[model samples]
Target: MSTPLEANQVEAIQGYDAEKRYKYLVKEVVANREIWILTDEHGCVMLNTDYEDCVPVWPNKEFAESWATGEWEDCKAESISLNKWHSRWTHGLEDDELAVVIFPNQDEDGLVVYPDELDFELKQQARKQNQR
Candidate 1:
């Protein structure tokens, strides 16, 4: 397992722009071999964007927990193993026509991407990591 992120590291990552944050998500999720999301009693949280319904994902629990405020106060941070994400989530999300919001910050700003796109990138990153 990966070491837990320090407070400063979390703070710094939260301050990053959307692109940088998305990149961080790719790297951290690959290293940790899991993807973080918010879930309440009902099910996984979903955000409605201008164009599509997106499921917000984070690189770690700390980042996911940060979003559990206000309306989402009851939400809990949950992890989906990278293997499960690739094997199940990718196909399920695509079938449901849902996108993914990668590492949203306080302002709820993030990069919306297709499930297949993210799955491909994560797979590529995992391959590169394995090679090193």
Candidate 2:
């Protein structure tokens, strides 16, 4: 069954173009520190942030918001343009250590990497990972 939208959420999202959609970043926090990568209902990982794409697009606001509420209640969602996503992803990131911290992803081990590294290659890796 499709989850019903909460009144406040519905109100907050009112006036949005139902026909228009944009990409959103959804995050899940673990242990109060580590941020885990979250996938959308389609199983695509939400790695785009305000720093990366110029026009990241989603199918619709409801599809984007589904991760923040409803069945995906544990995730947090943020709408982002493609440009913003890339911009924030690399902004203020210097050391490899800071890179990871600014942008984190799921690690091979259950324990997530905090203050993790975001080398240029990581972005490519994430995009490829999302395809899977």
Candidate 3:
């Protein structure tokens, strides 16, 4: 209920500080629509919609390792982009069912979330799922 900078604030700040101080950005998911970037105050930046840039990767030793190390570029160019990957993985899952799944990783906790097609194929099955 106080003063709130509109969308132009971000562009204004950017223009004002193009080569000056860089503000630290804290990105958080909120209300399924608004994106809040916090630093020292509220409404420093606001986005009305969601944004994601994720790349699909298989949850296996050979595949996950290759993706982490950038070895599968030649084979799966489309799936390597973060936008494509995130879209492919959570395509058919319900909103609540789209929770992140972490599998065991040789280096650490699992970091790969793959598409359902690769999932079924890797499981030695032949089922296809579609996005809604």
Candidate 4:
């Protein structure tokens, strides 16, 4: 059973979700207030926001699992890309938790947002090779 406080916290996290995706919560995932730049075992790169539920590359389920299992770190990829629809966000998840927030790319299509820069650049290099 959820205490009043807990219920309020979940409610706060589900703020104004007309689409019901990304929301803020009193329950925070990231133990640190700072952004952590992290690289997964596969070496993919991405910009991670605060410690909350981190957003990792989907389809790459292994990498996502790593972050959830405490095998990764948080780093804010603050490049600031905008979108036409504010409802849709490119959120990375941590464990089974919903994304507390997301990177600024805000695009649900394509590469979405890299959780770290170094890995992203490296993966891009691989993508280029595979394409050719």
Candidate 5:
């Protein structure tokens, strides 16, 4: 079951293309100061793609929870603060050569971005938010 707000959000972004979703993710994560990912007893979930392995991220828990079905049914939404993401996650993902899938939709479509590229965008978003 989803909250009314969550349902509204789902509806609102239903028509957003991948690029728009990616931009929404950057803005939301910066404003929220956290990023959401799915995790289970083992570890954070990773997606295997033809080109590279990707860590799927969302702007909020509700979005992350939307992906926690099927093979990821046991997964739980986890939050990583923006500071931790910058201090640790970006470097760790870069070392592992993992890309990031930003805010995938129900059809499993999202923008696949390199760790450095995403990190840069997140920082830029954060800076813009600070200037406001």
Candidate 6:
């Protein structure tokens, strides 16, 4: 487990570069047993196992907005950090589920991905459904 940061220390991170802040957030989520982050229908950050069960919990509006739009290239978001992006929305999670962070594509509307071994399969299914 990582050392818990005091409120002031956490506040200090606000001044950190996006890369540093992003890393710290991921570290916290992993240490807390891998809570996953997802986006709800309205593009707010959420937590839980399935997309349907997710509820908005994270607090960073700017980060959430960028992620909702997939404008992550400038954010230097790698797969791992991107998965942990939920931490950018808030400092804590509502539950512990596998430390994953899921993002919805602009085309996916109400759905999000879990990004595991089945990620490709899931994406294919989503595409097929969209083709309907």
lDDT of 4 by residue, 11-127 (tens): 443343422221111111111112212244553354444544443332112212323433334422221111211112323222234332231222231223223332333335445
RMSD of each: 0.9, 15.4, 19.3, 16.7, 2.7, 15.4
List the pairs of residues colliding in candidate 1: none
**TM-score of candidate 6 against the unseen true structure:** 0.28
Query: TM-score per candidate, in order?
Result: 0.96, 0.23, 0.20, 0.19, 0.93, 0.28
What are the per-residue Cα lDDT tens digits for candidate 5 across 1-132? 112246776768756888999998898888888898999998999987799999999887888888899888999999999899999999999999899998887874798999999999999988888898
Cα lDDT computed for each candidate against the true fold: 0.93, 0.33, 0.27, 0.29, 0.87, 0.36
How are the candidates ranked when ordered by TM-score, highest leading?
1, 5, 6, 2, 3, 4
Best by TM-score: 1
Arranged by lDDT, best first = 1, 5, 6, 2, 4, 3
lDDT, candidate 3, equals 0.27
Worst 10 residues of 1 by lDDT: 1-10
Off by over 4 Å in 1: none
Candidate 1 per-residue lDDT, tens place, 55-131, comes to: 99999999999999999999999999999999999999999999999999897489999999999999889899999
After the best TM-score superposition of candidate 5, give how far the Cα of residue 18 lies from its true spot, in angstroms.
Answer: 0.6
Candidate 2: regions farther than 4 A off: 1-64, 70-77, 92-119, 122-132
lDDT of 3 by residue, 79-119 (tens): 12323333543464334233222322233332323345333
lDDT winner between candidates 3 and 6: 6
lDDT value for candidate 2? 0.33
Error of 6 at 73 (Å): 29
- lDDT agreement of model 5 with the native: 0.87
Query: Which residue runs does candidate 6 get wrong by more than 4 Å?
Result: 1-4, 36-132
What's model 5's lDDT at 3?
25
Q: Report the lDDT of model 3 for residue 61.
A: 22
